[model samples]
Target chain A: MDRSNAMPTVLHAPISPADIAPFKIGDVVYISGVLYTARDKAHDRMLADPHLPFSLQDACIYHSGPLIVKEGDTYRVVSAGPTTSARMNAQTPSIVKQGVTAIIGKGGMSQEVARSFAGRCMYLAFTGGCGMLAREKIVEVLDVYYAELGATEAVWKLKVLNFGPLLVAIDSRGDSIYETVRARSHERLLRLIAERKRAL
Target chain B: MPSHREAFILHVAQALQEAETRLPRDVTRALANAAKVESNDRAKEQICTILENVKLAGAAGLPMCQDTGVPIFFVEIGREANIDFGLKEALATAVQRATDAVPLRKHAVYPLTRRSCDEPLFDMICDVSEGNRLSVAVLVKGAGSENVSALAMLEPLQDVRPFVLNTIWESGGKPCPPIIVGLGIGSTFDGCARLAKRTLLRSLEEDQSPFEAEILEQINELGIGPMGLGGDTTALRVFVEEAPCHTAMLPVAVAVQCWADRKARFSIKL
Candidate 1:
């Protein structure tokens, strides 16, 4: 509950595993520099393909499918926001093994995926559905990969500038805020059910 | 007179674009109010970012969310309208045009195979009414919130409250927090889901009944908070829509809407 310095700590991509390693569940941080986008299809491809289109060593992968329109051979991002990460739970552990230091998305991942972050990576919870906010942080779309998957699932390599007010939902130590919150909520739910039973 | 067919198509596309880029007033007001009262620092921060996102989208004239959701249209057609356009075909074409006009995300997929396509996607519920005008309201339902929606057939005399609460609780942060709950009670299973889905299009400014108020209070007490990060505003509101059911059945459907509950409406005089 330390509210000191409400502003998030600024981070740049291509960060060392140890750089994001210090962040705990609930630490507020911002990211700038290079990141790559990958959604469900991209996840499947990244795991099955022998060669990845781009390197992921100590890279940051954002769970996003941005809305981009081409302008004279360049892609101008109209809206770029994180998609739900839970859908990628099955593939995330393997993706992290590719040397991804941090993962950014909304609606935090499952326990199985969090376990994969044990001393290797962290998960950043971007504000869900905030394409406008995310777009401001993203300065440019440098390149895109896997266009065959359609626009929403393509992996867009992006150059960002101070790109986040990312909430650390999962720490490198394997703690997930989603789990903690669900547990607390479940306890209250039981109490609620008991109250209903008594009333009946 | 202009081409009613072309005009109608433009009308639907405009509604889709409006739904994409703008936050309807009621939804925006609720988010602002939720942000002001949220107690947890983390939850407050989430609200701040959401509020900032709203402003950013307005300034940029782009979609407030990249998901852009599946465009769902509620079409009310006038019975007396002198119309030659095939209503269904016109709507489908409008949706496809808007998919690019609004630059909506290419998200249509083959449900069975999960194969993605550039198809113009939309679902419509049509009703014939007594006027010479067609009214369409589009709701942009992003998948994050759409995936958590639920329907249940409770035993007769059983309470629907617990079912609704449980659905929201189980969803946790998956649907995004500070969500809107639309409850469709007492209909057939699929019918209940439709009832619940339609209620989400209603304005939050409308007066809430006692039951609606009660459910809203109980849900916020779950302490799921904003973004499920922990705080006062797990759900901004709960809307209940009910219909007559058979004596043996008590059906309930929960349609969840995220904080980015984007919707818009347009009426054309044909």
Candidate 2:
């Protein structure tokens, strides 16, 4: 893996099916544009609501519960990093159906989520716990929805500029680096356990 | 003028702020070393970004991670110490102050209702020490790692290796590797968890026991890598804390901690 050969592919959001089709697992990406924050609570609430305050058409959803604070009339993002996407696995297929083209999160989503990305969606993984780095990329807090769910759980609409260095862990073609890694690890785990037992 | 208790509370708040904003030297050094050893490009990128985030967070005096995490305090009180004020109340007050001052995100909520709570959320563990000083160490634990921490009571004959490996396997990237695996072996169920959690407070620079070193080697062999994306480094270190347990029980607790490994400590004589 020559680090120099793999420069990050930067995609501006409102990303379309065409925009994401070429990305494959192991490719690096950087996103710049509108990103909405939605954690577990916000996902459930959004799906349950018939009339959403915003549209998901060609949107990029960030699986994050940022540490944001309000100073007078404006909201400040102190830190904003991706939360585990697997936790949102149950809701993601439906979210993709709603037209979310790119899901920016950390960790990996389920194989079902990979299936959901068959033609239109992709999962970009920002390094988990790099909130400060993420915050630095977020240029503005455009607006917020579901404020009633409290600071951490609410939906925050944000404008970001080159908010990445994210890895394409799952892609539109129904392939996933996570699944590959998981299968390999499980096999190793079984072998290790078997060897330990044999030594006994 | 502020009283001694007030001063102590202020000290705790500062420590919390310090822990939240900066990556401790041991943790930072470990991550840097891991980054150098990573063979996978994606894994290397993640580790580099994490190092950059740590630097930015410290420079700006902002939290290194958004989930400023639940503050768990390990308080060591000397036997000869005398406390005129309520230590628990002071600690709670310090948490609230730190929450506001460090601007810690409010993470407390009523469990069943899922409604946010006004009071600060924290946990404290106290133990007696030899001196007349009160030493408090705060471990800032994020939900990603904390959620995956597991406790199992295996039969006395059962092997501990499989349980630890399985826990890490199931956790995958959810706990955010390269992580720290703190193993507590041979204690009561609850005590095992405490023992495991406490191991995280130790400096990563400390020498690992032979058993700890063996488990760590096995874990990295799984190649879950950084963020489980298939790399050479899945976990940076594994710390084991063992205790005597019931004859029939072989309790094991795996306390997973993310790379952030945020923590700070302060000691005061009263």
Candidate 3:
């Protein structure tokens, strides 16, 4: 697969669970068209309310709260950084089951989310703190889903180009870079300590 | 006092903006240095690319990375200053300006509502004392590092060594290694949290206390290295902050890792 020619892949909102199951680890997806941007609160509301503002099938939720600067009739994104995705550990599995095909955010997802969404959805870990660079990918902000949620938490419909240099940290196969690194580090530390103790 | 207040706020704000614009300078530098020394080519290359990207962003006036984190102010007020100026309000205003001018990413979220501010400015956690001289430290911590922050409460009689090692090991490359470890001992949970933040204020070359300096040396020996890619430079720096605590409880909060430990400071006289 030639990565450079991988034009953005667009998926509509309200994606189904089955739709999310097929995406592999390295595939670069550009979720343009439509999707809701919800963080902790929005997630809670969706969990509580039977009817949400929009459906979740075939959907991709981005863990971001962008800073939007308004000009004339339109708003421009000044800084749209990816928030810490680990904070959404509790909510991701449910959201994934609810038809979230992919998640774009900084950092890695939890073990539970990866296990729950095994071979179903992939987590794209975009570089955190590169809001300006990330903004370049967004061609235009189509609509703001929840104005009341404020800029950081508002759901934004965006049109994106190559939008990402995102990495496949957590894949549909239930593999996670975070878990692997952590476990290996722990093992290495333990071995070093034991060796030191024996030498002493 | 008035002159001092004005000077302090303006200087602090300027320092913060400069810090943001530079974006992870020390971290980028440290990562590049680590890459040179690292044995793993893949990890070294990754670190190199990350450093290059950060440099490019700085040159282009783009954010070093995306998560322009919550602006945390670690302030130390001296015992003899008399000023009527509202520091908090001034800070808010400065932050608002910085958000627009430097164009920092908004990061604050309304706790109860879970609603985030489209243009967040002030998420001030102030520390006050009785003096005329004030020292302020600003650390714009990105979410990547913040995600790896951990706290451990140990028994008064138990040693803190194991807990520290475990936390860092667990953190792994998650915090973007070759990280800075901020250890806070003896304070209450909240106090420990503040201590951890305060620890980041120290220069990468400075150590707050002797014990802390020793612990830092030990931690770097872990070999977590830059980007957790592995090397001798596991930690670029380690700062420890301690306070008095209860007899029965020895609260040790280890802010395990911060990838881009971006910090700047200013002093004011009133």
- Alpha-carbon TM-score of each model against the true structure: 0.96, 0.98, 0.78
RMSD of each: 1.6, 1.5, 4.8
Best candidate, TM-score-wise?
2
Candidate 1 lDDT by residue in tens digits, B98-152: 8777677778899988887656788899889998988998887889999999988
Candidate 3 lDDT over residue span A57-135, tens digit each = 6676777777676789998866565666777889888887877777877556678988987666778766555566667
- Models ranked on lDDT: 2, 1, 3
Residue pairs that clash (backbone atoms under 3 angstroms), model 1 = none
lDDT of 2 by residue, A62-147 (tens): 99999999999998899999998899999999999999999999889999889988799999889999999999899999999999
Query: Candidate 3 docking: what grade?
Result: acceptable
DockQ pick, better of 2 and 3: 2
lDDT of 2 by residue, B1-270 (tens): 345798889989999999999999999999999988788877888899899999999999989889989999999999887666788999999999988887888978999999999988899999998978989999989999999999998999888999999999999999889999999998798999999999999999999889999999999999999988989899999999999999999999999999989999999887
Which 10-residue window in model 2 chain A sums to the lowest lDDT? A1-10
**Segments in model 2 whose C-alpha atoms lie over 4 Å from true places:** A1-8, B1-3
Name the best candidate (by lDDT). 2
Badly placed stretches (over 4 Å) of model 1 are A1-3, A6-8
Every candidate's DockQ is: 0.80, 0.90, 0.27
Which digits, one per residue and each the tens of the lDDT, describe model 3 over residues B1-270?
Answer: 134556666776787776666744556666667778777644564455456556656676655555567778776777776555777867777777777777775667656765555555545566678768777778887666766677767778776777778777766556766678888888687788778777776666553477776666666666565544445666777788789998887888777545556677777776
Give candidate 3's whole-model lDDT.
0.67
TM-score of chain A of 1: 0.95
i-RMSD of model 3 (Å, 1 decimal): 3.4
